[model samples]
Target: MTKRIVVLGVSGSGKSLIGKSIADTLGYPFFDGDDFHSQANVDKMRQGTPLNDDDRKGWLATLNAILTDNPSAVIACSGLKPEYRAMLRNGLDDVTMIYLKGSIDTIWQRHQKRDGHYFNGREMLESQFATLVEPTEDEALVIDISQNADAVLKEALTLLANSPTH
Candidate 1:
């Protein structure tokens, strides 16, 4: 069966990096959710303004469409809220989520060191943390981003390989 994985976290948690590695290891196409956003959305975020639900509404629909149409892809999305995740999984099954968690300090440092990104590292951090609703008690494998990328990928791969759905 085709499997879909959502790599979720606040900005700078290495969701994009780790998600790419995971998808590559699993031989699945990888998508960075940021690339899916429209220019307007990007512009808004670039201005250090948080997007309201209305701004996200159509974007979520597009993500849903991608997930539905491409059954074999792994998507790296912030998916900051449960509602957003629900939207992504609207009609899908055999989907797994991996939360790449890191402390505020760690993420802050990473974001500060990051170059060429549109977002203001400081402002977006709070908004992302505020909107974040961690995975449910019964759902998802949470991986701490305290270690190197290699170790994190190994752990995530082990779970994917051993999972019943996989």
Candidate 2:
């Protein structure tokens, strides 16, 4: 009963933190989608440029391959669009998406505390929200992230445990 999970959210929405926790708890590998970005894409984000769909295509493909290769793993990715999520889950049957829902102000506070991260600026966060097509209940198990990290992790784990698919 291995689980394949993708923690989805905008930058600063605790994707990496929660995804890693889930992976560690489940004894599965954890991958940060940010690590898969090309140097060019990283530079663009660093320079405060919003990446269009073209910039994300190759990166999404790589992440998709990772999911395809690893049957049981947790991935942290800003899957903002329905198409992007579809691409990420292209060939995976048991994939579960956990969307970390948060407001811009909440995420902004979190982003301000970040250090040396490539994805920066308020405008970038705005762009992500604009691009985001929130998943419906059927598309994902949405988790509100205003709570403490421990609580969020507990909720996520509980949800996964109770999920009919699991």
List per-prediction Cα lDDT, in the order shown.
Answer: 0.83, 0.93
Off by over 4 Å in 1: 164-166
Estimate candidate 1's alpha-carbon lDDT, on a 0 to 1 scale. Answer: 0.83
**TM-score per model over all chains:** 0.93, 0.97
RMSD of each: 1.6, 1.2
Q: With candidate 2 superimposed using the best TM-score fit, by how many Å does residue 123's alpha carbon deviate from the native?
A: 0.5
Candidate 2 TM-score, true structure as reference: 0.97
What is the lDDT, from 0 to 100, of the residue 44 in candidate 1? 92
Per-residue CA lDDT of candidate 1, range 2-110, in tens?
A: 3788888888899889999988988888988888888998999999998878888888888778878887878888888888888878888777888888888889988
- Stretches > 4 Å off in candidate 2: none
